[model samples]
Target: MENKKELRNWLNKMELAHPLVIAGPCSAETEEQVLNIAHQLKDTDATVLRAGIWKPRTRPGNFEGVGALGLKWLQRAKNETGMLITTEVASPTHVDLAQKHDVDIFWIGARTTVSPFIVQEIAEALRGTDKPVLIKNPVNPDLALWLGAVERFYEAGVSNLGVIHRGFSTYEKTRYRNNPEWQIPIDLQNRFPDLPLILDPSHIAGRRDIIFDLCQTALDLNYDGLMIETHNDPDNAWSDAAQQITPETLDQITVDLRIRKEEGDAVEFRNKLATLRTKIDVVDHKLLEILGKRMKISDEIGKLKKDNNVAILQTRRWNEILGKMILEGEEQNLSEEFVLRIYKAIHQESINHQKKVISN
Candidate 1:
């Protein structure tokens, strides 16, 4: 841990620039494909050329990347273009190959981030190495699990670490393939203030048409950089054709982003805003006081139900409460859906209290 702190300070001294762009094909399909895309991106503001050498697919018989052989292509691209190379490494052997080929940066994918065992193994391999690493959030929304992965890497002596917010899978159908629960990453920033956060706009948007908007939003939120998927020819790309952008499109997007920088005096306002949060703390205390009184009322009702041999859950009463609250909150400009959810939770908890009292 101490060494990790020392390394983090050293990294801070180096101070890699913000808005660092990482771009390449989704997968290194062939030597020519990998080299061609890298050459095209060479002129762009891309800080690192990334390609997936070993893709962990949800199903078999899909393009699972080119495996170990693809590292050679990435090496050649780095050698020719003088551009830093990055690739996803799923296992210790993958890390070994990346190190052997002198790969500049490595990222652990969302699928791999879900498993602590895999992350630990990869971290052990990275121990004592000076190479920089990027850890993506898991496919699911688990902030603790994501932080745990980062801690494991830090504990294993990998100090130069970064986070990638790639969005999370959700059941709801929406424009995004993964819902950008921006709050989770914002919370992560609070916990690790020194760590750099990058946005994986391609994964979040899941469509080329919306990539620029997502990237712009990420920048507005003060993210350190973006990781976008680029292919020389998106029409002929082997994986994620719909999400891949051509080199020309990538260049335009870069130019467009420069013209859209976040508006004035965020840093000074944020410092003063921290002091204003004490007001929120006082209100929070009052809110808790009100909730305590509400819970006491619920306890009294539970006792009444117990004495009368009445059922704990009254469906008609719950329906009435929900209907009334939804209408009332809507009149106050609150979302009806939000009111329904909050009231239902309260109703369920009230029933649970009644059950406990009756059983006693």
Candidate 2:
């Protein structure tokens, strides 16, 4: 994985006029159902049809996918519509089965990506594969784990690679079904600009209403493509019905979503952009300087607490600071979520500093 840029070779080979759209039902319910959705999406922006033949649900007795039988339906759909087909492969057996069915592409699910052993098994199973394989981010927000999964596949000599950002699981209640920690994917994209980055907004939104917004955000950030779960009858879909949209809705969403330019063309635009970026750099520098000062103050406080034989953690004070910061953050047009994440990181760093002082 030394040259992550090579991951884009498969995508570049396609030379698609529009962003790659992989759309289909969450699970392949039946041959008729699969073909019905495929025919509908065939006219849309969707370049690929995706389905789950063996869904590994969080719990049992919840329609654990149609198994290998569903692959037949996806094959039929591909034969009829001539669209590229993809499916999730959790194990080596799945890899063999999907290859047998001639699945055009393969994706590793979030749950599978969480486990190194499973990823290794699948990667070995897919060794020397010429077809594209997409790796989804892990269920939790662990970028290292996600990268490790990708590297495993790469090490196994599967160079045709891409990644899906399907958001991350969080206990906190929010409008989203999963927390869209945008920075994680952004960081990945920053480090490996050529690595294909696709966003699975269906899982992130968990409802049809906000899928458009999420897709728009991804396109605005220059995502390579999107994977949306779409069904002919979304409300009555067998699995993940809440997140599934109708093919018509998916078509409209693609039409409505805006894709912004990555860079300016005109000199005037470039000058303005450069000026704005300079201001951001200056602000970022100031923020780091302020953090340095804050850490110094934290070190002094840690020394005083050590001399007084007091514990490093002051839960009540931390809560009060967080509450006040949230209110002040609102006035500055900073979200409570942003304030919370920033302060939490700072607090952890302060604790680390205090720990060092206590140890000495």
Candidate 3:
């Protein structure tokens, strides 16, 4: 691991065509898939090719991954194309294998990022190695946990540190598969001003159609790179079909992307970002207080509805609230659509509380 000064100097000297892309399939499904994409992307500016060798899926009986054998295929891709290679390392053994195979970069996935024990183990494995390691945010939106994982990697002596802002898992139904809380990564950059940050549009959008827009938005926010999933046949991909793009699609996206400068000194921009975040913190606290009051009122409503044996789904009341809130949001320059979505969630929770009260 590089110390902060060493890492900054390395990033500065890399001469990356701002917004360096690092793309490949979600998993190296086969050698053919890896090679085909590698051939297609050979002339492109992607600094590293990423693929999942050990996919940790939630359910059993699904396509877990090709395992350690896939590492050989990645090495082959690097040998054939002369491009750098990267893969996710979930365990100390994974670290050992990747190091043994001369894998250029290793990323800690969101699933592994959530567990301090796993992060520490991986860190320990990487203690003597100088491999460039990227840490993705945790599956949930826990900033402290994410930072801790990065700090661990740094403590372990890995200097080429970076972060992949792949969005966060949430219960809300969003157009995005993962909520692109752009603010979270921005907050990260504010604290670690020298840290390189990349965006994983594939995981965040979770649909090919939205990857372009997400990439554009990440660029607008001055992210350092993109880690998109590109497969030869997205529709027939073995895993995450909706999120995978064809190599042709990724090629088009690269052509279409516009990289932006940070507008000013990186540190200055981060300080400004911090000021905006401080404002968000104040507003968020007030919003939570209001939500607490609203829940209290909801409890009262629940008691009344239970006493009257009324069903929790009061369509008329919901319609009124939605209408009023939408109008109010528009007046305040908030996206009416966004406000409606938030209120709908709050309303659903209120209904759930009422139902529970009625049942008990």
Candidate 4:
């Protein structure tokens, strides 16, 4: 964990044109399937081929995975395509089998990353090896748990480490399969600037249509790489079919993506950006002042309601406020989702103030 420079060594070793691209099928269905996808991705931006060997499905009666047999397929694919092969290792046995088959890299999936015991087991299994390990974020949005998984690997002497931000699960309905609580990964980057952070747009999008945009966003945010699910025939893929894109589509997405520079050295650009940021700072301060004044009014209303013996939560009034704000937000080109989130937080704060007044 302390040796930050060592953790990024693997990424430094990779010779890639467009950041590091790890592309392959969601699951290794067969030797032919794995090999075909690997061959198609060989000439693309993808330098590492990833396939789920021991897939951990949410429910039973699904194609879990090809098990250890798929590792052989991955090995064969690597041999033919000359691309490094990677697979998900949930258990110590998986690590043993993957190592036996000469798999080049191992990634801990979201499910496995959530459990410290499993992560520890896999880390212990990989104790002496120097294989590059990529860990996906946990199912929930817990940054500490995700960082702990990485620390476990580092403690086990696995220095070649990276993280995959595949988004997080939430009960609330969202356009994305997983809510890309982008701040979590951004915070992680701020904490560990040396550790490479890759974006898993496939899991985050859960559909191919938005993968290109998501990739562009991640690249703009300075992610180290991307792990996209690419298949030979995406429509008929066994698992997560909707999220998988054809190898050709992946190629085009990589081509179309605009990778922005992290920072500019020009003094003029810096001055202009600083001026714009100062303007934003002023607006932010004014916004906070307005919010504080609104909360004071809310407290006054709460005291009035308490004196009148009226309920604090006026459902109809809340609905009206939300509808009005959403309409006004749309007029200003703001998304309903963004407006809802902002208003909901404010509403909760107001409720908290009312609760305190009522209790007193």
Task: For each candidate in turn, give its C-alpha RMSD to the true structure in angstroms.
Answer: 10.1, 9.8, 8.2, 9.5
The reply for model 2, stretches above 4 Å from the true place, is 1-9, 261-264, 267-360
Q: Write the per-residue lDDT of candidate 2 for residues 123-148, one digit (tens) a residue.
A: 99999988889999999999999999
Q: What are the TM-scores, per candidate, against the unseen true structure?
A: 0.73, 0.75, 0.74, 0.76
- Model 3 spans with C-alpha error above 4 angstroms: 1-15, 262-360
Error (Å) of candidate 4 at residue 240 is 0.3
**lDDT, candidate 4, 1-360, per-residue tens:** 433355445556665444789999999999899989999999898999999988899999999998998888888888888898899999999888888999888899999999999999999999967888889999999999999999999889887888999999988677799988777887798799788889999999999999998887777666778999999999999999999999999999988987644355685565446545644554575478679889988999999999999999999999999999999999999999999999999999999998998899
Assess the local accuracy of residue 221 in candidate 3 as a C-alpha lDDT between 0 and 100.
60
Model 4 C-alpha lDDT versus the unseen true structure? 0.87
In order, what lDDT does every prediction score? Answer: 0.83, 0.87, 0.83, 0.87
Name the Cα RMSD for model 2.
Answer: 9.8
Give the CA lDDT, 0 to 100, for residue 53 in model 2.
Answer: 91
175: Cα error in model 3, Å: 1.6
Clashing pairs in 3: 1-157, 1-158, 1-159, 2-158, 2-159
Best by TM-score: 4
Q: Which candidate do you rate higher for TM-score, 2 or 3?
A: 2
Model 3 residue 2 CA deviation (Å) reads: 8.5
Clashes of 3: 5
What digit string (tens of lDDT, one per residue) describes model 3 on residues 1-360? 334445446545654455668888888899888888887777776767889999999789999999999989889999998878999999999988988888988999999999999999999999867667889999999899999999998888777788999989988676778876766787887788778888999889888888998887666665667899988788888899999987778878988976544466996677557556654764575477679778878888999988988888989988998999999999999998799889989988898877777788
lDDT of 1 at 33: 91
Better of 1 and 2 by lDDT: 2
Report model 3's TM-score to 2 decimal places. 0.74
